[model samples]
Target: MYNPTVARLTYRALLGRRRALILFALPALLILMSVVVRMFVGVDDRVAAEVLGGFALATMVPLIGVIAGTGAIGPEIDDGSIVYLLSKPVKRSEIIITKLFVAVAVTMAFSAIPTFVAGWILNGNGQQIAIAYTVAALVASIAYSALFLLLGTVSRHAVVIGLVYALGWEALFGSLVAGARTLSVQQWSLAVAERIGTGDEITSDVGLPLATTLLVAVSVAATWYASQKLRTLTLAGEE
Candidate 1:
């Protein structure tokens, strides 16, 4: 297997220094919100589920994914540091795979872990809500990372575009449009959660089998396409 040194460089750049703060912020906010909600509202599973669903899964997960996935490659591409990697002997496809791996890990760590902790704080595993959403967060992390990693490799405005898709399309449109629910990562993940949750605590517009298929398909396809895109990746200018 031809390894990618570019991938290593991409990981260092994405995770190093200032960008780590953005990664920390999202999860931190989730935890903080959980604490505040617990203090004020006491231990209510419904409120906990709502908070975790509305804020943690809907808002924090996507934002962290945008930061991790796009930041993994976009800044390098923008600043032309990608040229050094492009000029190397490593396979570009390997670069994408490596970066995708890093992005997914980062997303999982930042989003999934905190979501689990927050869920516990909110309701202490009541009706298995914490575990259910945690699983959903893990699943969502993989898809979000792959999608935004591809966006990063291809677009200069990947972060902005990713945020818009995550926030505007998924959060906003999915909320307002019943049909849009079928296309949402949030809803898809919720489908998985619904199976794990007791009663009607966690529900989704899509069914378990369909959501499972879409989640796996999207994550795999996006990762594969991202690797393909990176093989033909063109560096920006020396200008």
Candidate 2:
């Protein structure tokens, strides 16, 4: 189902631009803040949890997901360059799968790795805080990539829409609104982190069973829908 050529082109499209800078900047900020915090407060599990959960998983991961996932296909569609790609003999599903893989990889590298490094630095791996959030970032990467990729395929304003969802739904509503948490990729990934990480350092709004189911469902459904959209896609001047 995966196409290496499409994956290669998608990676080039994603990383060879200014969005690449944001990818680098967010992780750099996370690591920098972790060092400053550790130097000042010393090691504390609660502090580690706050840093990893509040910023890394909640903010950085989704932001990177928006950039990577939407950037994977949005730019091409916007520039009317996808017609060339669609004219290929490859199945639309393969293209979506390849782009999804690229998006997931980019998200994981830019978000999850930094979360782990920052987590370790925060508490020196105490209470397995770094590991937990890293796992959280990893799973969140997959779901966010698929979700935002669908947004990219379906909307011309994919990046803007993605930012609102990531910042608004995830960063704001998920924290304050009790019901929104269940629909959040952050909460679902936190469920996995809750399973792996020891201590109160990690928690989730939903249980493991429900979170796992939703995470898998969202990723599959989004990818499937994106494929369907691409299969029926029509560009300007098409007959």
Candidate 3:
């Protein structure tokens, strides 16, 4: 459902105002860090790996996912602007799917592309690091978008919950607890990167087949569940 009108509305809300700034900010920071690292350290593949893995994939991608995914519907639900779309004869599922598509595209564009650029800048694509991380970024984009979009549909504190999941769970506990890595998008996508990259350059706690299955399952299930949630979505009274 390529709803041009819904797509247009989603694009405007995504790129308009302060959210746009955050969208630009993450990639800008990545490029800036890449430039600084290249200038001082001079194109070390290991450094490239560190920057991309530590910052780009681990941090920026998830942050952008949070913004795009949650932002796609959270504000609409909050201010009750979703009523405009709901009042139309359009199926609520169409609206959710359309918004989900937009969110995934936005997340991929902002996170994955920049990750590739930063990867190349840091190491000139040595050992296929750029392409590998780029692939992971792309895969992660889909999952993160679906998860956060679902968060938007059901929770008022979508951004907060997303941040906690991204930062606290994935970033913090994932590092500390072995079990946490199994449920992490960061680790799951890293598994993809691991398959593409050279020995030990990219590693993931999760395996390739499991990560692939989980990634696909999570994306599909979240998107479907979001559509169902949107069907019966109710706006809170302005108490």
Candidate 4:
């Protein structure tokens, strides 16, 4: 579980100058909005739920997930720097696991912590809304990191695909079509939040058991598949 070297490299790559700014931007915006909303509208549980569910959970978490997850390995693979790691004696699984851990940690830092802060700002943690959504963000970080890390391993357009899934599929289709909600990461996460939050302020379309199952299954399957892909990854020789 501990791979200090790989973890160090992944953290540096993820929080590099340009990328670090993008990583922090959304959470900053969310907190700012919370402050603005609380100032003008005053404390309201419904508004708090909407702000957290609509913006923090729906938009910020997935986008940060895309950045952390794909960025953990995509850039290395693209620039052919991954060869340095692969050429070593380390197991491919170790490399994937280390990067996945880094991605999950980064995602939680950027998404979940800020979400808690924003939720509290929105409604003073009324009905335990802030804590509930924060839990959802934390749970989501794990699954999203695994899924997008796999995407980074297998596809050149990892970020684009992730954005499409996060924005188009989860945000758009999942909102318009009831069936799509059943398969959405956002909805699944909200299910967890629903269980934690008092009252029906933060409800989800999916049930708790189903959501928990999907979250675990997705995280495990994606991590396993990514390790397999990395094991057989082919690097082209310089011509």
Candidate 5:
């Protein structure tokens, strides 16, 4: 249920000047941080792991996900423009899926690519750390896109809610609360990365099997729910 037109429009809005600035900002910072760390700290595998894992994976990925995911549909919904899209011939599900696809693409581009570059810069791909965390960023992108796109459909305050969840719950509480870590997208992605990484430094609280299952489940469930929400918006459009 893909729609090219829906995808094009979603891409335009997300990559528009303001949103593009936010999307690019983190990746730039990550690269700069990598350069700074490299110049000052020199090449140490542990330091590389600390920078990429602590800042890149933990902070950058989720924040970019929040921006890309929410910006995909939130603006359209907020300004009543979604009614125009809803009134079109496209099915509600197609619209939701298309937006989800765009969101995932943007998140991956802004996050996964830079993560690899930064990883390379940090340690010249030592211990496969660059590849490992890049894999994590890619996996994390899909789940975050679906989850935050669903948020866009349901809440006008989706961005705010996402920020709180990303910075507060994820980056903070996830480290402290064992239960919170289990439910986290970050942890789930890290599980996959843990396998790819050679050294013992890369770790995850959740096992790979459990992480894969949860990632797939969350992405599918969120996309399905967002489609349902848009179907109701179809009726709202007709009114």
Candidate 6:
């Protein structure tokens, strides 16, 4: 269920000079930090969880998601290039689906792979910690892509709004308020990691069943809503 042309365009748009620098920078920082931490602290599971959870999962993933997801459609819509695609015979849903796929792939590649490498650097995959957090990064990528894709479709300020949600809400409020954890993408993804990792170092506020349900529901609903928005998209005349 992919359109190759749309996918290619989306990939190019996302991997352009500036955005690619941003996408690569965070993961590189994460790996660098992992190496430094390993040198200083030696291999410890607690340190591994803290680094992965605090920086990789909390900061890097959402930032990359915001860039990739909003970048997939926001620029096209802003520059009026989307009108050419809209005027075509292709289904609106196909365009959204293809772009969504591209965004998810980019997010996973930039975020998850580095997370795995960082985890390994931290503990050599001891107690399955590296693999567990890698799985969390993978799961988080899907939900973040769909949600930010919908934001890109509906708002010109998609990146700002995404940062607010990712940083202000998910990080700040989720730490301050206990109830906020239940509604967090980070927590839901952590739930998956918790189940996979044997150690108690990695944990989540949400349960497995509830987390899985929320993950699936958010991804499906966001994609559906984005496709619907695309179907009804309007182009304004330049006065």
lDDT of 2 by residue, 1-239 (tens): 99999998998888885878889999999999999999999998999999999999889999999999999998898898999999888998999999999999999999989999998899988888899899889999999999999999999999999999999999999877998999999999999999988897688989999999999999999999999998778533266
Q: How far is candidate 6 from the true structure (C-alpha RMSD, Å)?
A: 1.8
Q: Weakest 10 consecutive residues, lDDT, candidate 3? A: 230-239
The TM-score values for the models, in the order shown, are: 0.92, 0.97, 0.95, 0.97, 0.98, 0.97
Point out where model 3 deviates above 4 Å: 234-239
The segments of candidate 5 whose C-alpha lies over 4 angstroms from its true place after superposition are none
Clashes found in each candidate (C-alpha, N, C closer than 3 A): 0, 0, 0, 0, 0, 0
lDDT of 3: 0.90
Q: List the residue pairs that clash in candidate 1.
A: none
- Candidates in order have lDDT scores of 0.84, 0.92, 0.90, 0.93, 0.92, 0.92
The per-residue C-alpha lDDT of model 4 at residue 37 equals 95
Better of 1 and 3 by lDDT: 3
Question: What clash count does candidate 6 reach?
Answer: 0
Candidate 1 residue lDDT tens string, 61-127? 8888899889888888788777877777766677777788788888898988999999999999999
Per-residue accuracy of model 4 over 57-169 as CA lDDT, tens digit each: 88899999999999999999999899888888788899999999999999999999999999889888999999999999999999999999999999999999999998998
Better of 2 and 3 by TM-score: 2
How well is each residue in 1-239 modelled by candidate 5, as lDDT tens digits?
Answer: 89999999989999999988888999999999999999998988889888888888888999999998999999989999888887778888888898999999999999999999999999999999999999999999999999999999999999999999989877887756898999999899999999999998798999999999999999999999999998887776677
